[model samples]
Target: MEGFPEKGIKMGNMTIKDIAKKCGVGVSTVSRAMNNHPDINPKTKELIMKTIEEFNYVPNNSARNLKRIQSKAIAVLVKGIGNTFFSDIVSGLERECQKKNYSCILQHVEEQEDELDIALHIIKEKKLQGLIFLGGSFSHPKEKMEQLEVPYVLSTIRTAGENCEQYAAVSVDDFKESYKMTEYLLQLGHERIAILTAPKEDESIGKLRLMGYAQALKDKKIPVQEELIGYMDAKKDRYSFQTGYKLTKELLKKTDFTALYATSDTLAIGACRALKEAGISVPDECSVAGFDGMEAGEFYIPSITTIRQPVEKIAKATAELLFDMIKGKEVPRQLVFEGELLERESTAFSSCHESVK
Candidate 1:
């Protein structure tokens, strides 16, 4: 029989550590191989599995619940339900989980719901090994975070008014990217530039982007006009197409500007629809630009000029950091990526600017 030795080891005598030692690999590596994680080298994984079978090793039972077998799984808390910008990031995270042989659970939190509370509940219910928070703002009290015993990462989201030293985060610098976009529009000779932004009370990336726009106008010696700034409704708008259209329509009724900068591609596309209905030509009568380069914006009739965030890079980094944390090989840290500006069809030199120059 090609199986256990004739002089068999006692049942449950071989622990994971013993298996790992027999396989000449780390405990984590052995665990990954046992779980069929793709990150492990194929030959090494085969060796580890063969050793496990030869040793008659059995995995440990979870202390949390004696009746249930603990799984190597993680959860991702997605704040915005229908936000397209988060779709690709979510998919990337799922792929990473597959490589690590961990199951990924995607849970969406409502606009007014508390994400941390949701996270705590899910961690307990699913016996999650780790977690990732995607989208939304995080400014919870330090003690609240302490309640989460499992390793976690903040992906594509910024914490406001918090000591970030104790958390791991992967994201683009929203303020810097927003500033770059605003400056680009300004250089195109748009003096009376308008912005479609987050609600006034927003404290996360929305607030950062808005600040970038204000600072850019200030640096240019252009007085910021309150009338030209459009704010979305917190209750009804989840950065959707309708929100963008509605905000632009309201801005059109109140002010006349040469350029419109939206904080997201979804909002920019919505603004374009509104502008089209009002008989204003994009880059002819008014220019439009956006942030978070979504695919829809690229194929729009008047392609959007926007800041393209490195979503795939951010997502991969987030998975690596979270896994490192879980392995006790890394401490809390922040990773900020730079965005690229793609100047496309929607923005151009202002007609008034040419006349003035």
Candidate 2:
């Protein structure tokens, strides 16, 4: 019920406190209203929002985040919002950040979003001390990499080109891990193994994983069937459960295989769902394997077989690497960890060994 601002002040100069003063409310009330908190009265929030709208008040994140020149905060930019595999990594990052007296901001980049562009904008706006890139295929040219001026670490993703030597990274050897999983499937006598993975053009982890799968097949004297490869749709969420489901359904229609290996645990679960709807028995009829070692895979209906990477260790290491680089304590480097393959309910020895191609 208070009066509005005078016509003289610049739009950007109006603060949340100014809005609160005009609304006869506290700054916290204005903040909760702006963010749509559940506990606020509908009418009060509506009034606050309308008052904010009338003034064209936009929060200046840069000013709010920076204490002086730095924010004391780090960002974890995850490429896909739907990937559950990144959840634990996020938690680990948050914990490590808190232990180091830094704030953590989690950001999600939609499927096919340009991560570097978004990251550059976020770093400027938030005055972030460093960045921890959680997912997405990073094969940026040096020009693009150089644009990200702040210290950053790539976790659980792959990067290529000579410019990668300039950044910090922590992850498993996707190529080696994939080879191990595929060889396990092959040892189970699965000659016609189908791989659900990233598109061929992907030059990151997806490419490495696919390479490992191909190498395992060649070593076993099994020709890599071109038709059996399941590539992710560019328009859909990559490394996602639904992507896995849809791709598996399409693969079933076009090819015949005794076993399936999904590049992620979420994808593996999706593949299992598709196989279930098709009335195909898991392990008994078709062995399935997954990567990422997410806990969800462990509790699923049949319990998934997967190559488990130490999520906490990798995440903490990623944080440590980024912080060290930011503090000028270390040079940018790639940290590789070993992955363990777990044999579980989702995979079994091929039932049709005699019928195998």
lDDT string, candidate 1, 184-205, tens digits: 9888889999999877878778
Quote the lDDT for 20 in model 2. 87
Model 1, residue 139: C-alpha shift (Å): 2.9
Stretches off by above 4 angstroms in model 1 are 1-71, 355-357
Among all candidates shown, the one with the greatest TM-score: 1
Query: For model 2, how does the per-residue alpha-carbon lDDT over 61-94 read when each residue is reduced to its tens digit?
Result: 6666657336588899998768888888899889
Q: State the displacement of the C-alpha of residue 127, model 1, in Å, after optimal TM-score superposition.
A: 1.3
Can you list the residue pairs that collide in candidate 2? none
lDDT of 1 at 86: 92
